[model samples]
Target: MQDIIGRIGMRKAALGVLALAGATILAALAYEHIGGYVPCELCYRQRWAYYIGIPAALVAALFVRSRPALAAGALAVVGMAFLLNTGLGIHHAGVEWGWWPGPAGCSGGVQVSTDTGALIESLRNGQTVRCDEPAFRFLGLSFAGWNAVISLGLAVLAGLGLQRFARRHLAAV
Candidate 1:
């Protein structure tokens, strides 16, 4: 896998990263909109990396040939974003597994209202999703766990591609 990644040029690698990030975000949106899976606060937060990475990958791809340094920088940023996202995924997964508690807002809670009207309104607007619970799990891994795996893979790919670009272009400069 490392050899294959090392061999893929900067532009191709950037495109690959873009494709993967796009597909993952699209899948998450589909799960939420089409499949009726409501995302908790953390689930929504986990998407930040993909949102940032997609454009960065595109920029990297576009500038790869014209300005290799700029492309390398963009790819490095994408790699770092994915790496941070991987940590977030792992934290969310741990929360789901009861290894640690989730945030106060996302973990399970009800707002106290003394007024009858306020109570009714609060009930109507209450949060339905809890970050501590896994909405779905497959192969002993929840969505968060799968996200961690995918994010780590993306980070590694970006890193490998950056390394290759540096060797081929930066080293020559």
Candidate 2:
């Protein structure tokens, strides 16, 4: 582990992690843009973590020279992203199962006015977040379901990478 960390160092590893994180973001974008998939509220929530992780990795790589320390920062960011995605996935799945309510802002606000014209306008605007709907699926898994699996795996990778750095740089392993 230590040998790997010393060899790759902070900058390279951080760059690599950031690159992977970017790839995931791009993939999600493609799913929405090219694949014509829409994101649910939970999907957007998952994106928040990626946003955080990307900056964390890039900044740590750029300014932080110490490999182990920088890796820790990067891992924390990515790991948080992963955990958040996992939670979103679970929550979305629950929503699909009618377990709870999703955020009103993205899902749908309470219909305040009962005017027929206003109702028609809202319908025409196509303003719905449809938390029950799964926008895309991979191997029969919805985006949220797949996110749960992939994000957990990514978290493991980040942890291993960080552990390698710590063991090599600090533990003399």
Candidate 3:
């Protein structure tokens, strides 16, 4: 299995990474659009990684054929995206766990504006989505928790690709 995967090379691995990121985004959209899961601000923020990772991975795949160094650099970008996502996931999960407060704009108790007109306007605009609560939990993990797990896995894969690429480059030199 390891030999087969190695033979498949970095391009295919990059494609797989991109595919996973795309599928994950698609599933999140489905959950929001089809399953009626409204996303909070933090949820939306968590998606930035995928938004960046998918295209980056595609570019990496494209360059992998003729420009191995460029492909490796792109993989590094993908890895950074996932690493940033992992940090966000951990922070969000901590928020959910009540380890600390979330952002003032999105989480915590209700706020009443000082001015009467502003208060009325705030009420008219509707409630703000809180970051500290999960819309739903699956298998004892929130969406943020799941994202952490998945993003970490992607980061590891990218790291492995980096390692493999470096080893090959070193051997040739």
Candidate 4:
């Protein structure tokens, strides 16, 4: 098994990372498109972490298969991704609880006195997505809430994978 995996090389690792990334993206898309969830500004910011993570993981996979790089990259990607998500969760929670004002442009709680026409246009375009609103839910929490929990789990798993397979990988290659 070890020999087979060794032969498979970084290509396999890249695919695995990509697979995880793809799954994450698909889940988000499903939630938004199929499930009819509208994402907020912070939610989009969290998604940007995914965008960076997937490619960085791919490049890290393409490296000389160093365990440290591979494992560290895996951990970093997940960590960074989760970090962004964590912020989003806190912000969303604040929005839900009204702890602080959300982004001025969106959040619906923001104040603007430009004109009735501009206000109407902004409302019509949905210019700013709000954090307070619960667009969709899987259990009881909103998607941002769910992302906070799930990303934490994924980060831990990535760390474990680095600790486990990473050593053998470094020795083999």
Specify the poorest-scoring 10-residue window by lDDT in model 1. Answer: 104-113
Q: Look at candidate 2 and tell me the lDDT of residue 32.
A: 89
* TM-score of candidate 2 to 2 decimals: 0.74
lDDT for predicted candidate 1 compared with the true structure: 0.90
Question: Model 3, residue 121: what's the lDDT?
Answer: 89
lDDT of 2 by residue, 1-173 (tens): 66664465455656776887788889999988998777766788888877887888777677655454655776667767777777777888776656787777655556556898998888898766677766656677777777777677656656665665676667764
Candidate 4, superposed: residue stretches over 4 Å from native: 1-17, 64-75, 97-100, 114-117, 164-173
lDDT of 1 by residue, 1-173 (tens): 76786788778778989999899999999999999899999999999999899899999999988888899999999999999999999999999999988997778764566999987886789655889999999999999999999999999889888888778776767
TM-score, every prediction: 0.92, 0.74, 0.90, 0.68
Which residue pairs clash within candidate 2?
2-168
lDDT of model number 3? 0.85
Runs with alpha carbons beyond 4 Å of true place in candidate 2: 1-13, 63-71, 97-112, 116-121, 169-173
lDDT of predicted model 4: 0.65
lDDT per residue as tens, model 3, 1-173: 67754654567768878888888999999999999888888889999999888888888889986999999999989989999999999899888878888887887765667999998888898778788888888898889889998899788777777777877886889
Candidate 4 per-residue lDDT over residues 1-173, each given as its tens digit: 65643453334544554676669778998878998777888787768766776776666565635555654665567556756666777677667666777776567867785899988886787656677676766667777777667556544444444545556656788
Residue 147's lDDT within candidate 2 is: 71
Local error of candidate 1 at 114, Å?
A: 3.4
Q: What is the C-alpha lDDT of each candidate?
A: 0.90, 0.71, 0.85, 0.65
The count of backbone overlaps in candidate 4 is 0
